[model samples]
Target: MTATVPTSALNLVGKVFKPSELRFPAMPPLGLYIHLPWCVRKCPYCDFNSHLAPDSPLREVGTASVIPLKDARNPRDEAPLTHALPVDLQRRYLDALIADLDQQLPKVWGRKLHSVFIGGGTPSLFEPALIDELLGAVRARLGMPMSGEITMEANPGTFELARFEGYRQAGVSRLSIGVQSFSDSHLASLGRVHGGEQARAAVAAAVQLFDEVNLDLMYGLPGQGVEDALADVNMALGLGTTHLSLYQLTMEPNTLFAAHPPELPDDEVLSDIEDAVHARVAQAGFERYEVSAFCKPGHRCQHNLNYWGFGDYLGIGAGAHAKISYPNRIERETRHRNPQAYMDEMLAQARPAEVRSLTVQELPFEFMLNALRLIDGVPDAYFVERCGRPLSDLQGALKAALDKGLLDPKPGVLKATPLGLRFLNDLQSLFL
Candidate 1:
């Protein structure tokens, strides 16, 4: 919701910004990611910018993929699918995603989105009437973001569970469902094309057709243990989900399980399967909020808490990645990661993106790399309301992260000290 206005006049709804060096006091809430990059079967430990659908017949069914490799067996290292898919590829990629949302609606003019997500390489492999004509072209250009929280990510593959009740009548008010492990041999050793009765009948028809449902589990597989990762978190907390993201399997660098490396679960059984799936998702009430999220307490994930509270997102499609912010500076952009070269340079309106502008030596290590992956960290007035600097600009890395207890000397809250969420990459490189 965030826009009350006049943070000492950086203009809004009367428009008058542009003059940098940070100071915005209000204006952080916007969100809306999108990226439906396509994916029928590209999961040898996916490296994400997903692409196999040239015309998804689940692309020759991954030639029956099986890579949970402790030793290799030929599949000819699969990866190779994209080849001219435009016989109106989903209505020319939904009119180049509503002209790339009218070229990012004047950098989010008069903001109010508050959450949309729709993430990819498998945004339910598109078609709930092209996600109801892309959420009715984002409610005809952001007039209150489809009345808040749209979500979308689906993947259980049996004709994508009949497009989840037409993606909740095409408004998709949250669905997630990537069920990354219910185990049909860890879904054919992670090449996944649905198994374990199509991830329990796509989470029982997406928890009876969406009302905030999410389930994307995973935890050091390739013959998992620790009760097969707490029986995939007690069968995703016996279904009726509210939200849970839980990822853990790693091998990423150009994928195919980093060129055949899967024999996982051995750092003492992946730390007792991440301490028994984080104490069985906190004994089934669930609330770990961020750092692979967990919900069911007014269900967090308002587009990843507007990206761990740094807020502002725009993203769009094919390799999308936005950040946006103003009343001084902040930027990020991206686009063009080949979906027919971002629909041939954004339907020839020509703006395949790149952007830039963050540097104040990279905004306090990109605002604690998303506010210390929050278990609670944030609200020391979200560092002058979303990094317009000065929480004493990380006062000597917040007194060496509060003298290396690693942070959360509380009092105002920037959090992380369960030994800094277990050395969260040495507490986010101590603000770099």
Candidate 2:
């Protein structure tokens, strides 16, 4: 067997760095990302780092009495609070996450957060009180805006008026309900617990409390026809949500569906569904901003927009990932995936992160990869603002792509033509 490489040997630059040389820039318009990694049951199509409880032996643990984790410099800062579970149930593991964030805050203490998103296996599984406490801690530590966007992803089955209201009162201004599809067969095939009616009720509750409500719908399911997918889109629009994120189902590695491949719709049917959904959504006053996202005026998800625009964000919790912009380059970091492993690493005072710095050669392609996702391509100047470079930086590759008619001839800006968007891989390959 090949000799094992040390963790430090696997630096982001593929080269080892001395401690003194390792520094990241003050992240830009920072945002917070919290991952909740537990689920009642795992979805076959979901490749997210999540797991269901197993028949394991007993273990009673209490980090509650332990001093609440605070930022190293700002001792007054509060963090997320977790629900207490009996010895038999799985723990929330919030203490470890708070400790991890505390250790990271010194690197970026005074930055103002643009958004905060709580995503998960099922974020609603956490008690509303825990969410309230978490947001309270965020405001105490990071100084969020009075009207900043706070979004949480939830499942339809886990809903109550009190909990929804608590989330609003806790400072959450947006809600993204995971209503993958309205068809019972589609929902069942995806192993989703909620039915069609449950999705409706969940949207109703969210609309009542949050100013921005988004529905997460999935298309191109196993055995799903174009008409079936269109029906799902129509049903979601009827709910009157401000935003909708319709994703084409992808069979990612390690997912149950990948291991046992299902009979998915052919490319023709998939294309039909995409065309139908796009037309219907446009006619209903919703504009297709991102490839899979549709929104009313000013209703786009700011957090996702930041991501696509290559903005900075801090990710916390097991399996969370983050990207930060520094003076000369961008750095990517990831937390340990295992809950137990993350806690152990945090409790030992060792950094539970791995970092990488990007090179000049990689920046242009990276910027275009994200910016081109918008329906209307970004202005030429945004490249410099975000990537800290100019459009002329990648002239050779741009000229090649332009000669191939893959890019529009719009001076100072790069826009993908219809053919380019269809074969984006080929267009992007030129940059690579």
Candidate 3:
């Protein structure tokens, strides 16, 4: 629990009060992130704050059925998942969601949102009617502008044409389906509920119902080859999706895969696979706009763009995080991680959590983390506007980066060089 620095020392509302104090730059565009924290089953490689649904089978402990991680079976051979939360339970969760938003409204009062994204453990598991009610409730509470983009993350295992249509009618303009791979063995290796055929069918159906659809795919699996990665990318491109998110599977800390340790591809094989996949997607007319995202012209995901641009967002739900700005500082907020506990606290009208304003010393590294990931990078002026510091402040670090050829020498832009994008970790670390 870090404390927010006192704002009394800064009299200037829209400018930096001193060299040591943070500036109050003009507010950046704001977005909304709504989290639904239940999934069908937790994947071995996934470290997201997801939990098993209540309706899922549980191991008995002293006459009580519990959903614990100690079931001790092979994660890759998990039982077939059930994709429904009872209707009554959905209603309860929805109630807590609205209350959560109501309490956070004052923090972002009257700000026009640039976009809204409903992400999850598995948002599609709840029925479409629940989604409709949730979105409708948001609109009723806020003065959101009539913007076109409202994205929802859905799982392919629960794909249904009618459900998609219902979502479209409910105003979800974009759909991002979690189709990790289009091969049956690869899908099982990732502990996915949907098979290859189901993934293809779902993408096909979704493209027909919605004009904009995105597919999520992974590379560098336990035994995947370059050809296998290419096959998955080709299948996604052929499915008429507007965007593709190709991520290399990495074993994050605290995940089952990290502890059990799958035999992942070596660095050499992974490099070859990534090069082939990148070249193939570019040839098919998808621009690699960000590190892991590709899309056709004019179909960028607005919600994610806000994130990478270091813009403001209000996050509400279990285990969700948000970054908001005020007259003199930026604040970060997080909610309770457990779904049941989050619901109980919110429904009781309890205050969610306190946030510490980002200090001046931590601003540069924080801004670079998101801004440098863009292929084109951010403009030099954007640094002054968003980060509230003149380019002169980074004179030493910028010169070192240019001397090492890690950043472009082009004036007015702060882009990473080709080599910098390759070793992005080393490049971003310079700011720290």
lDDT of 2 by residue, 1-432 (tens): 011222322222223334223222223457789887766556777889765534212121121121112210111122111221222233336666667778778767667788999998677767776777777777778887533799998877566677788888888899999999887667767766566766778888889899999999998888898889889888888888999998999989877677776788999999998888888899999987777789998888888877776777889887889887766568778988876687778767677568887676787788778767776666655555565554456679888988888888887456777777887878877876
Task: Give the poorly placed runs of model 2, Cα more than 4 Å off.
Answer: 1-27, 53-92
Q: What lDDT does model 3 reach?
A: 0.79
lDDT of 2 at 295: 94
- RMSD to the true structure for each prediction, in A, is 17.8, 11.8, 6.4
What's the CA error at residue 162 for candidate 2, in Å?
2.1
Q: Considering TM-score, where higher is better, how would the candidates rank from best to worst? A: 3, 2, 1
Instruction: Give stretches of model 3 more than 4 Å off.
Output: 1-17, 57-83, 144-147
Q: Write the per-residue lDDT of candidate 3 for residues 252-274, one digit (tens) a residue.
A: 99877777767789999999999
Give the top-scoring candidate (lDDT).
3
Clashing residue pairs, backbone N/CA/C < 3 A, model 1: none
lDDT of 1 at 184: 74
Candidate 1 residue lDDT tens string, 285-313: 98887778888888776778678777888
lDDT of each: 0.75, 0.72, 0.79
TM-score of each: 0.35, 0.83, 0.89
Weakest 10 consecutive residues of candidate 3 by summed lDDT: 1-10
How do the candidates rank by lDDT, highest first? 3, 1, 2
Candidate 1 stretches with Cα past 4 Å from truth are 1-24, 29-34, 42-54, 57-80, 103-107, 110-119, 122-188, 192-219, 224-268, 272-306, 315-379, 383-407, 410-412, 419-432
